[model samples]
Target: EPEVTQTPSHQVTQMGQEVILRCVPISNHLYFYWYRQILGQKVEFLVSFYNNEISEKSEIFDDQFSVERPDGSNFTLKIRSTKLEDSAMYFCASTGLRGLRNSPLHFGNGTRLTVT
Candidate 1:
C-alpha cells in the first residue's frame, strides 16, 4: 500500500520564524492536501493541490501560507511567519482518484510544529 511520507516528524521554532514542511505523496496519487490539528481541536483542511495548481483552499490558508509541488513527487507547505497559534500537527495526504463524493484521503503521520 502506498502512503504519504513527511520529513522531520517534529519541529520546534520561535515565533516569527519561517518553516517549511515537506511531504511526498503516494507516487500514483493525483490529489494532494494539507490539513492541521491544533492540540485539542478537530482536524482542519488547509489546501488541496491538483494538476499543478491549487484546486481548493480553506480560509485558514491565508497570505501567510503557501503550498507547492517543486517536483512531481514532492509537495511542500511553507509558513512565512510562525505565530504561537500556528503551532499544530500538520498532516499531508493524498488520494489516487478524484470526483468521487466519498474518496478517502490517505494521510501522513504528521509533523508536530511547536512555536514558542
Candidate 2:
C-alpha cells in the first residue's frame, strides 16, 4: 500500500489568520480529499478533488477553505481568516481509480490546527 504524508504536524494560529495545511499523497492515486475532526467530534468530509478540479465539497468547505494540487506530488488545504471553530485535525486522503472498495482511502496522520 502507498502512504500519505502531512507536514508541520501541528500548527497554532490566532483567529482571523490564514494557514495552509500541506500533504503529499500516494504518487499514482487519482482522487484526493480533505477531512477534519473537531475535538470529540466525528470526522467530517471537507472536499474531494479529481482531474485538477474540485469534484465535491461539503457546506463546511465554505468560502473560508480552498484546495490545490500545486504540483504532481503535493496537495494542499488552505484556510483563510480561520475562526476558532476551525480548530481540528485536518486529514489528507487519497484513493486509486478503482474507487473506495478496491482502493480504500489512504489517510495521512493529519495536521492539528489550533485556532486561538
Candidate 3:
C-alpha cells in the first residue's frame, strides 16, 4: 500500500516568516487532509481537499494558512507570516475510495515546524 510522504521531517524558522510544508499523498486516494498537533496537545484538523478544491477548513486555518494541490501527485500547506503559536507537527493524510468515516486514513510521519 502506498503511503503519504512528507518532506523535511523538521523545520526551524523565526517568527513572522512564511513556510510551506509539502506532501505527496497516495496517488489513488480521493480525499486529502491537513492536520496539526501542538506539542503535547490533541491533533487539530486544518483543512480537507477533494477534486482539486478545498472541502473544509477549521478556524485555526485562518488567513495565514492555505492548502493546495498544485499537481496531481502533490499537496501542500502554506503558512504565511508564521507566528510562534504556529509551531506544531503538521500531518498529511489521505483516504481511499470510501469517504473518511468509512475508509482507513493513511498519514505521513509529519513535518515538525518550530517557530521561534
Candidate 4:
C-alpha cells in the first residue's frame, strides 16, 4: 500500500535555529495536511494545502511556519524561527476525496522536533 514517509525521524536544534521537516506524501493522493502533537498534548492541525494554495490553516500556523511542495513527491514544512514550544512530533498526512463516513488520513510515523 502507498504510505507517507518522513525523514530525520528525530532532530535537535537550538531555540532559534531554523529547521525544515520533510515528508513524502503518498502518490496519487490530492489532499495534504500537517499536524503536530506536543509531548503529551492532543494532535493539532497546522495547515492543509492543495492546488498550489492553502486550503485551510489553523492558528498554530503563524508567520514563522510555511509549507511548500518543492517537488512532485516532496512536501516540506519550514519553521523560520524555532521556539521551545515547537518541540513536538510533526505528522504528515494525505487522503483522497472519498468516503465521507471514513475520511481516513494516512500519517507518517512522524518527525520528532526537539528544541532546547
Pairs that collide, model 1: none
lDDT of 4 by residue, 1-116 (tens): 88899998999999989999999998977889999999989999999988877899999999999999988999999999999999999999988767633779999999999999
* Candidate 4: stretches off by over 4 Å: 97-102
Superposed Cα deviation of residue 32, candidate 2 (Å): 0.2
Checking candidate 4 for backbone clashes, the offending pairs are: none
The sequence of per-residue lDDT tens digits that candidate 1 reaches over residues 48-110 is 998999999999999999999999899999999999999999999999576645889999999
TM-score of 3: 0.96
How does candidate 1 fare on TM-score?
0.95
lDDT of every model, 2 decimals: 0.95, 0.95, 0.93, 0.93
Which one wins by TM-score: 2 or 4?
A: 2
lDDT of 3 by residue, 38-100 (tens): 999999999999898999999998999988899889999999999999999999999867656
Model 4 TM = 0.95
Per-residue error (Å), model 2, residue 58: 0.4
RMSD per candidate (Å) reads 1.1, 1.2, 1.0, 1.3
In model 2, the runs with Cα more than 4 Å from the true position are: none
